[model samples]
Target: MHNDALCNFWTSTLGERPPARPRLTAHLQADVAIVGAGFTGLWTAYYLKRLSPALNIVVLEAERVGHGASGRNGGWVVGNLAGLERHIGGLSLDERRLCCGVVADNVDELGGVLAREGIDADFHKGGAIYAAARYRDQVAIQRGYLQHLHDLGHRETDCCWLDAGQLAEKARFRDGYGGIYHRQVATVNPARLVTGLAECAERLGVTIHEHSRAEILERRKVSTGEGSVEAPTIVCATEGYADGFHDFKRHVLPVQSLVVATEPLSESVWQEIGMAERPAFSDASRLINYGHRTADGRIVFGARGSYRLGARSKADQAIGEAAMRMRRDLLVDLLPALEGVRITHGWGGSLGLSRNFRPHAILDRRHGLATAGGYAGEGVAASHLFGRTLADMILERDTELARMPWAFADASHRQLIKRWEIEPLRWLAAQAITFSYAGEEALMRRGKPLPLIKPALQRMNDYFASVIE
Candidate 1:
C-alpha cells in the first residue's frame, strides 16, 4: 500500500492504516457496479443499500479508498455549487429557491449522516467568511459576489454581508474589508469521511474491491485486469481521476489542486487569528484561496490549481517545495500572525471540471449506466447530494432530488454533456485563463490608478468567466 502519511495530513490523522481490501480476481455478478470507490461511489453504494437492502452492489477502486480528491481535498463542505447559475439561471424564483434550499440543507444532512454512522471526522458547522482582505478593490468584488448570490436565490439568513468589524470578529484577515458570511458552509477531515463511509457501505453489504482499476467498461460490465463484474446498472464515478479510462474524462477533465497544513498553533496564535467559531475563510481573489481552522488547532489552507496538458491526472501525493512555499506565503499574507508557523504537510490531487461548469447526476436506463460528478472542486458536499440523486434515479424513485435541474434520467451523458476541445486547444485555453487571472491579481496588488488597464482587464476576465464558467 502507498504510504498514507506521505499523501496528506488528513490520512496521517488516521493513525495506522487499515488492512487492504482484496482486489477483484474473479468475475462476479451484481445488481449494480460502481467505478472508483471515492465519495461519489461510496455515497451511492451506501444510499442504494439503505433504500434497497436486497440489491447486490459492488464498488471498484484504482487505489485505496479516498485515493483521489475524496481523500486529498481541503475539506470545505460548501452549501453552494460551483457554476450554479448555469443550472438554475433561467428557472423561476420559487423553483430556484427549492434547488438552493436542497443544496444548503445538504451540509446539515451530511453532518447528520456522520453522526448516525458514529464517524468522528471533526465535523463542524460554524459557517464561512468570504472576506475582502488585502487591497481596497476587493471590497467591491466581494459585494458584487454577494449580490450575485442573492440574485441566484440564496436567502438573506443563509448568506449575509458582514461589515469590517463583523468580519474581524469572525476571522482576522489582514485588511478585513467586509465580505459575505455564508451560514451554510462547514469543514471536515475528508480522508476520515471517505474511509468511514466506505466501511459503513460495507456494513450495508456493498462489496468493494480496492486496487482494482477498471480497464474496460461496457454497457453492463466493468472489467479490471483479472476480473469483471456484470450488473444491470453500471456507474462511472471516477470524476477527475478518470485518466482516459472511459469517455467520462472528455466531459469532465482533471485540474490539479494542492493544499498545505500548518502545525498546531498556540492558543495565543489562535487568539490573534480569531476563528473562535472555526469558520472557513477565503480572500477575494479569482485565484481562489480558502482555508479553515482545523479541530486540532491548525490552519488547513489551499488555493486554485492548474490544469495539466493532455488532461492527465496527478498520480502522486507529494507537491513540489516551491508550490508549498507559495501556499505558505499566501496563508501568511492572509493572517500575518502565522508568519513563522511551520507547514507540516503538502499534497496535490486532481479535481473534475466539466465543460458546462455545473455538476450533474445522470442515469441512462436504456444503457444501464449512471454517473454523478463534475463538481468543479465542490465535490465534497456536491458528491453526497449527487450520489443520493443517482441512487434515486437508478431506483426509479419519484423523489424531489431526482427531479432537480441537474438530474437527468432519460438521456445519455454523450448526448447531454459536450465534449472538451482537443489537446493543445484545451491546454492553451487553460494557460490563457490562468495568465489573465494572475495579471488581474497583480494589478489588484499594485493598488494604483491605472484605471483603463484595470477595468479593461477586469472586463476581459468577466468575459472569460462568462464563457468558461
Candidate 2:
C-alpha cells in the first residue's frame, strides 16, 4: 500500500517527470556555486548576480528543475511558521516584529522578482486563508492569535477573519468553524515559478546544470560522482532529498508529505462551492490537513504524511494506504458532502526539517563551503527569504540581515543510527498519532469535548507544508 501510494502521488499529481540532467563530469571553478536548483539554489544564484554581475555563479540540480518540494508543493507561498503565534511570549516586541516583518516581506519580494523578470508563474497576491476546522479550533485561534495579529499591527486588507458558516461556502470549502485571512500571501504554479527562475537566472548569465547532483563536499570544493566543483563559496539547497551529505541525517528530518489534486472544477461548480476568500486553509489538529484552490480551480492538498520523530524519513518513501485513508477521511470532515469528488493526482515529497521551525543556510565560513537545509515545512516564502539572505552572506563577508538564529547555528552533523532502529520507530510514532488524531477529529465533529491534549495539538500535523514536507 505504501509503495503504491508513493509511486502514484510522486509521479502523477506532481506533474511531468523531470528531464534527465547530465551529471557533473569535469572539475570546474567559479566564484560561487549553488547545490540544489530549487528556490533556494536559484534564488541564491539570482541574488548573488544581482549584487555583483561580474562574479561567476553556477547552480547544479540533481533532477530536472523543481523536481524537489518546490515543484511538488501545492503552490502556497507563505512567510510565517505555523504555530509561531503561540511562541511569542519569549520574544521581545521588537524581535517579534522583525520576525513578522521578514515573513510579511517574503511574498512581496517574490512578487517583485517575478514581475521584474516577467515570469508568469500564475502569481496571485490576493491573500490566503488559515482556517479552523472545528468549533474548538475556532475558539482557540480567536482567543489567542487574534490578539497577536492586533499586537503586530500587521493587519492588511487581505488579512482578517471569517466564521464557520462563511467557511462552508468557500470555493471547495466543505466545513469549518472559521478562518483567518492572511494578506500578503499568494499562490503560484510552483513548477512554472521554478522553471521561470531557472530561465531568469540563466538570462542573467548564471549557468545552471540540470541532472547534476553533488555528492561530496571538501573544505571549499564539492565533488559530484561525475565531476568536482571548486568555488569560493557553495550553498546546499536540497530540501528533503539532501541525504547526499554526512551531516544531513542529524541536522534535518526528511519528511514524506502526500498531496492530491482534484480535476479542474467546472466554472459553475467553482462559483457555487468556492469562497470569495482565496487563501489556503489548515485546521487545528494534532495532524493538520491543508489545501488551496489554484487559479485554474483544481484543489491541491497535503498534510503530515511524514513523521520521523526518532527515525529517518526519506522522499522516495511511500505514504501508504492507511495514511491516505486518514487524509481522505479528514478531508471529508472538513468538507463533508464531497465524498464523491475524485482525487486525480496523488503524491508526496520530503522536506528537510530542522528541529527549529526556520529555514537555514549553514556555512563553513572560513572554508568557503556552506550548507543550508531544514525548512521544517515552511519553505515557500522562507526558502526565498533564506536564499536571498544566504546570498548576501556569501557575496559580502557578512550580511546586514542579523546572524542566523541560534537554532540554525549548528554545524551540520550526520545522525547516529543503525539501519534497523530509527526508521521503524518513526513509522510507529506516526501511525499512533494518525490513529489518535483521527479519532479525536471524529469526536470533535460530534460536538464531544476534546480530550485534554487534543485542542493543544490541533495543529500538529501542520508540520506538513513546512519546507521539508
Candidate 3:
C-alpha cells in the first residue's frame, strides 16, 4: 500500500478529525512549556493541571495530537516497562518489589483515570498471554523469561505460568505449549485514548497549540517558527518523533514499527481462534510479535520493526505491500483459523529506543528542564506513570512516585542517559542483530537439532539482547 492510500485503524474509529488547534502565533508565558502533544506531553499536562489547577501550562505539537507513536502503537497497555530489569537490577529486594508494584498498579490506575474522565477508549483489563506457540524451544525460552520476571520482583499472583490446557482455555494457539499469564496487563484503543487525553488536558485548563513545532529548546524557553513560550520549566516529551529537536534525538533513537488489523471476523471464526477473554498475546520469537482481540471483533497484530540508517523518524502511516504481507503471513501462521481473513489496515510509526535500553523520567531542576520517554515500544502505560512522576517532580511533591528508581530528580539527562552510537556503526549493528535473529528463528522453525550452530547463535543473540534490550 502507498502512503496516501493507507489509513490507521485507530484514527478511522474516531470517525473524523477535529479542527486543528491554532498554531502558536503570539509569545506566551506559562508556569511550564511542553513540546509534543502525544501521551507523555498531554498526560503530563493533565496531571499538572489536575494537581494544581491554578498553574499555567502550554503544549506545543509538531502535528495533530496522537499523530506520533501514541496513535500508532499496538494498543497493549502493558503493566511493565520494556527495559525494566536495568532499572531495578541493582536495587534491594524490597525496593525492587516496591517499584514493580508501582508499575503493575499503573495499568489499573490508568483505567481508573479513563473511567473517571469518561473516556471510553475501549479499556479492557483481560490481561496478557506471552505464549510459547511456535516451537518446543519457545517453551524453555518462556520459562526462563517467567523466572526473570519473578527475579525482577514481579509478584507471583500478577505473573504466573499457565500450562498447555490453561493456555488453551485463554487462547488456542497453533502449538499452545504454555505461557505466562500476566494479570496486570490490558489493552486500549490508542487513538481514542490520546485524543481523549488531549481533550481532558484542555478541559483541565491546559493551552495546547497544534502544528507548533518546537524549533529550539533552551533552558526555560521553547521557540517555534512564529512564536515562542517562556516559562519557569520546559519539557521535551517528543519520544520517537523527536527528530532534530534539541539533543533528544541523539539520546533516544527512533526505530520504525508496523502494525496491521484484520477485518472483523465471524463469531464462529472467533470461536475457533479462542481469544474469548480478549487478552493480548505474543509468541516467543526474537522477531517480536504481539496481538490482541479487539473489542470490535478484529485482530490487531504487530511484529519486530527495523532501525533506519540515520535514525530517521517515520512520518507517514502507510507501509509497503511486502511489509504488510509479511505480517499477515506471520499472523496466519500463528492462528490458522484466519487462513483467508482479510486485513483491513496496515500502518507504521517510529518508537524511541534509549542507548541504555531503560526508560527514564528526568527533572533537571538546575537547568529548568524535564523530560520523559524512551519507551522502547511500551509507551502506552509507561507514559502515564512517567508523566505523573514528572508532574510530581515538577511540583516538588515528596511522593513515592518521585522516589522511584526510574524517576531521576535534579539531574540532567545528558549526564545520566548515554548517547547512541554514531550513524553507520549504529545502523550496522542493528542490521547484524536483525540478521542473526532471523537466522536463529529459521533454524528453530526447521526443528532440526543442529546442536552446535543453534546453541552458538542463541548465545550470541542473548548477548545482543543484553546489550540493547
Candidate 4:
C-alpha cells in the first residue's frame, strides 16, 4: 500500500504539459479582468468572448489553468441545485422548473459545445442513480425522495424509482434495497473539459496569464504578486480559494471532498458491477458518497471528508492514510467484488460552500465586481450557466438567463443569519454530525428503527431555515 498522496489522477492522466505562459509582470488594462483560471473564470471568459468578440478579456491564475477544484471534482453535471427548494421556496413552480431546466440544458449545451469545438473530453449523458444500501437510505428514498419528486411536479418517469433487481441492471450494491434515478445528469473528464474551455477562450482572443496570483481585488482593479490589471469590470471567480481575500471570507466556506480511483478492472468484474451506460451513482447517505464508471474502465468513488478547523484552509494535502483507507473500504462495501482491486489514485480538493447552500451569481455594477460560485459539490454544469448569466448581465443582454433567481447583485442581508458559529463550536458541530451519521449507518445495518439523530439534524436544519427567513 504505497501512499501516493500528492498527485491528482485527472492531471496525471493528461501526462506531460507544455510550459506555463509568462506570468503577468507589467501592468495591463482590459475590458474585463478575471481572477482564477479554473472553470468559473474560464467559462466566464469563453462566454464573454463569444458574446462580444471584440471585448478585451484577461484571466489571471494563481497557478496553471484547471489547477483547482475544476480539475479534481467528481465530474457529475447534475441539474439539481445545492440547496434544493429550501433556498428557492419563493419561486413559483413554473419558475423553479425553468430554473432547473436551464441548469439541465447547460449540461447538454456543454456536450454540444465540446463536440462543436472538437474537444474530446469523453462526455457522457449517462444520468445518475442513488442506491438504497441501508435502512436510512431506504427510508430516505421510499419516504422522503418520492414525495420530493412529486412536490417538484416531476413525472414518474422523470425520476423513476427502481427496485433492487432493476438497480442490479445498472450496478450492484451489497445492501441494495431500492432507489431513484434521474436522467438529466452527465459525466465528463473534468480536467479535460476545463483545459479545453481555457483553450477555446484563448483562441477567442482572451489573454491568460499562468502563475499570476491575484493578491488583492478592488473596484475595477486586481493587484497580483507580479503585476496589476485595471479594467472597467473585474470578476472574482476564485471559488474555494476565496478565503485568503478578506472581502469574500463571510460569503463562502471551503469544504474538502476526497476521491479514490481503482486500477483498471477486467470485463468480468465490470459485468458483475454493471454500469454499462456509465451512470454516476451514490448511496442515499446524508454524508454524500458519489461514484461513476470511467471511460478507461475505472471505478472512481468519493465522499466529503473531514474539514479544516480554521476558516482559511488552503490546498492542504487530503489523502491521509486513514482517509484513503476509509474511502477504499467504502468502495468495497458498495461493491463486494472489488475487495482486491488496487487503488491507483487517492486525492481530494476543496469546494466552495455558501451560507444558503445554493450557488450564487451576482454582478454588482456599483462595485464593478461580478462573482459566481458556491456550488457546494455540484459545480460542473452550474458554472457554465452561471458564467453565461454573468456575461449576459455584463453585456446588458436582456435574456431569460439573466432573470434567474440568483442573478441579483447583493446578498448581504440574506447572508446575515447564515453567519455560522465561530471555530471550535462549528468544528464540534461538524464532527458531531459526522459521528452521528456513522452511528446511524451502523444501526441501519441491523435493521434497527430510525434514531434520534435524524430528527435532531432536521430540527437544526429547520432552525437555521427559520432564522434565515
Candidate 5:
C-alpha cells in the first residue's frame, strides 16, 4: 500500500497534530540522522538526547510524525514478543526463555520510560485479557499458554478461568465456554506518545524534518526530497513501509490491518459490553480481534494481518463492513450485553511483519549506516526497545540493555512474497483459513474431525500471515 500515512486510526481523531517544524530542504550536518518519524525514529532521537544533551540529532520523515503503523494501530501494548517464539525451532529452550524474558522486560521498561519522562499518552496500566471462544481455541490456549510461560520462566502470573456463569458476569459476551484472562497489558493514544517524544527531542536540540521522504542513503549522506542530510550516522527506522529499502524487503512483509472506533456509548455500554476483566482483551485466533476501552469510554478495536499491505489490497474497502460486522457480531460474540451501539469511525493501518516475528534491528554498515524494523504487530514495545538500542549503538555507548540478542544484519528471505502480490495471496490464505475452520466445524458437526492439520495451519499462520479468524 502507499501506506496512506494520513489515515491513522489514533492520529485522525486527535484534535490537533503537532506543529511541523519544516521539511529538510537543504543540506544539513548532524551527529545522527534518524529516518522515519515513527516510534523507532522518535525514540532513537529521544534516547540520544537523553544520553548527550549536546549531540546534534536530526530526524527525517517521509510524512508527518507518527504517520506509520506506529500511530495508526490498535492501542494494545502487549508484553508478548513480536517475532520471538518463531525462532525457537533453531534455539535451545533456555535461550528462547531468556529471549522471552527480554520481551516481558521490555513491557515493564516502557511503563517506566513513559512515566519517568512524564509523558501521558492516555496510557492505561490495567493490563489485558486473552479470551477463548471455542473448544478448539481453548485447547490451544491450555496447551500453549502455561507451557510457554514455564519454559521461559516469566513473571509470576495466573490465568483467571471464568466458568459459564462467571464469564456471563465478567464480560457481557454473546456465547462461549469460558475464557482466560492475562494481566499486565496496556493501551495508549499512540499518536500522543510519538508526538510527545518528538517534542521532547526537539527541546533537547534534536531537529525533526517531516514530509521529507528519504529516497536513498549512504554512510554519511541520506538523500531526501529537496536536499540530503549528511551525518556521522544514519539510522533507518522505517518498518513495514520498507518499499525503497532492499535489505528490509525480505525480512518484513507489510500487512494491512483494520480498526474501528465507535462514538461513546452510554455508561451502561462500558459497564456491560466494553468491560474487560483485565482492561485490554484479545481472542485466540490467527487473525485476532483485539480491543480495549478508552478512558473516554470509546471502544477502539483492530485486527492483525487481516490483509496484505499494498495499494491494491481490499483493506480499504473492508474497513466499513469490517467495522459494522465487528460491532454487530464480534462485539456481541465477546459480549452480548450491548449489541446496538453505533460505530462512528472505521480505519485500517499497515504493519511491518517479520519472518521470525521478533522486531529488532541495528546496523552500521560503514562508519554509521544502521537500520531497524519488523515490529510484526507489537511495535508499541519493540519500537521503543530497538530505538534505544540503535541509538546507543550509533554513539558507541555500551550497555546491557543495548546488547540485544538480535541485531539488524543481512537478514533476508529468498522465498519472500512480493509487496504488490502480498495482499492477494494473503487474502486467499485468509479465505483458505476460513474454509479450513468452517470445514473443521462442519466435520466436527458430523463427528469427523481431521485433528491433524490444525498445527500445520498454525505453523502457516506463525510463519506466513495470520489473516483469518
Candidate 6:
C-alpha cells in the first residue's frame, strides 16, 4: 500500500487537495531560505513575515507539506517538555520556570493563531490525563508528578493529582488507580493544521516550492536537483528526514513511532469511556505511549515501535503486524470497553532524536544558519515556540522566547542514543532493550515483582541518570 494512504487519517478525510505548489525551477534569492515545509518551517516563515512583511522567504520541500511526523502524529498539542531539567540541567528554578511557561503559552498561542487566521483544524483545548493503571505505575507517577512540580518550584494548582474517583470524571480506564490532569493540552487535526498554515503563509507572501529536494546545503546556498536557492540565511527544518543531508545525518537519528486508529464509535461508547471532552490520555511507561479522541469520534493511539536495523529512517511502510497487534492490545488494556471496536487505520512516522535528546533551535549568525528539530515526538506545540524563537534570534531581538533554554543551547553534547555503533551490535542492543521493556511491563501488569528485568532496567536508568548528572 502507498504510504500516502496509511500516512494519516486526517488527510484521508480531506477528500483531495488542489495540486501542490510548483517545484523550484530557477535559482532564487531570498532573505531566508527554509529547507522543510512542515510545522517548524511554516511556523518560522509565518512569524518572520509577520515580524517583517518585506523580508523575502522561500520554503523548499522534499515532499508535500505535513507528509512527515507533523501530519502523522497522534494530534495532541501538548505542553510536555521533551527533556526537562536533563536538557538544561544547570539551570536555576527561575530558568526552568521560564521554559515551562513558554511551553504552556505555546499551546494557547497556537489556538489564537488558528482563530485569527480563519483556519479550522478541529482544535479543542480540553486538556490531558496521565493514567497510572498498575500499582507500579501509580507509585512511579506520583513520585514523578511531585518531583515535576518541585523541579519547577510550582504550586499544586499548576497540575493536580487525581484520586481514582476524580480520575473517573476524566477517564474510565481499566485498573486506573490514579492520574495527573493538566488543563493546558489540546487536540487538533494535525494534517489540517499544517496544510492550513501552508495556505496562510502563501497568503502572507511566502513562496513555497514542493518537490524541491535540497541535495546540497552550503553557507549561502541550497542546491536542489531542479534548482538552487541563494541566501545569506538558511534554516534546516527537516526534523526526522535530516539524515538525507550530509551535514545533518550524523547529528540526528530518526526513530520510528507507530499509531493506530479505530473506526468511529457511537456516542454511547464515548460516554462509557468517559472521554466526553476528548482529553488526550497515556499511561506511565518508559516506552512512550499516547492517544487522543479524533474529531470524527475515533480513538487514535500510538507508541514507540520496532526500531529499524542501524536506526535507518527510510520509507518502510511495513510496521510489523505483531507490533500493531501489541499496540491494539495495549489500547484495549487501557479501555476494555473498546475490545470489539474495529481498527480502521495503522501507520508509522519517524521523530528526530538528537544527540543530547533536547529539542534545539539554534541561530548561528556567524555561519548564517539557524535550525530547530530533534523534538522526539513532542513537536506539535513545541515547534510553534521553536519557530518564533528562531525568528527572534535571527532578527537579533532580546525577547523572552529567544532567551529560553533550548533556544540557544549547545548542540555538541553526546549521549547513549547518539553514539553510533556498528550495525549488528546496534541492532541487537535495540532489540534487547525493547524486549526487556516489554517483559518488565508485562510483569508490572500481572502485579508480579519486576525482579527479572530489574538489573537491566536499573543499568539503563543509571546510564541516563549519569548523562543527566
Number of the top candidate by lDDT?
Answer: 3
Q: Against the true structure, what is each candidate's TM-score?
A: 0.98, 0.82, 0.99, 0.93, 0.83, 0.93
Candidate 5: segments with Cα more than 4 A from true spot: 1-9, 86-98, 134-137, 158-170, 274-278, 305-318, 322-328, 408-469
Report how far off residue 87 is in candidate 6 (Å): 4.2
Q: Pick the winner on TM-score between candidates 1 and 4.
A: 1
Residue-level lDDT tens digits of model 2 in 1-469: 3443334432343455455546678889988888888988888888888888998887888767777888777677875654354345367777767667766777898888899899988788756666766556455655356566757535444356767675566534454567676777787777788888888988899988877778886766877778877887877777677667665555566767777766676776667656555567676664556777776677777786656555344545345566666666666666665566776566677776555444455655666766655565667777787777777667554653535342222244232111222556556755766776676566666776657656555555344323223
State the local distance difference test value for candidate 1: 0.91
* Local accuracy by lDDT, each model: 0.91, 0.66, 0.92, 0.79, 0.66, 0.79
Summarize candidate 1's per-residue lDDT along 1-469 as a digit string, tens digits: 2354764999999988878899999999999999999999999999999999999999999889999999989999999999888889999999998889999999999999999999888999989998888988999999999999888998889999999998888888888889999999999999999999999999999999999999998889999999999999999999998875657778889999999999999999988989999999988888888899999999999987899999999898888888899999999998999998999999888998888787899998888988888898899999999999999999999999999999999789998778899989999999999999999999999999797999999999999888776
TM-score of 4: 0.93
Q: Residue-wise lDDT of candidate 4 within 123-165, one digit each (tens)? A: 9999888778655446464556767764664445557888878
* Each prediction's number of clashing residue pairs: 0, 31, 0, 0, 13, 0
Quick one: how many clashes does candidate 5 have? 13
lDDT of 3 by residue, 1-469 (tens): 5532256888888876778999999999899999999999999999999999999999999989988999878999998998988888999999889999999999999999999999989999999999999898899999999999999999999999999999999989888999999999999999999999999899889999999888999989999999999999999998998776658888999988899999999999989989888999999998899999999999999986899988889888898778889999999988999999898899988999899889999999988999999899999999999999999999999999999889999899899889988879999999999999999999999989999999999999999998987
Q: How do the residues 1-469 of candidate 5 rate in per-residue lDDT, one tens digit apiece?
A: 1324333446655666557769888998888888888898888888888888888888888878877777767887776654454444367766765666776667678888788888778877766656565444554554466566555544556344556566555565554555655554678888778877777778778888888988986757899869888887788787777767665554556677777776676876666563644377766654467888877777777765444424222323235564556544665556655567677566675777655455566565454677776666778877877777876776677775555566543332222322333556655765676565554434433433456765565465544433221
| RMSD in order of candidates | 1.2, 4.9, 1.1, 2.7, 4.4, 2.7
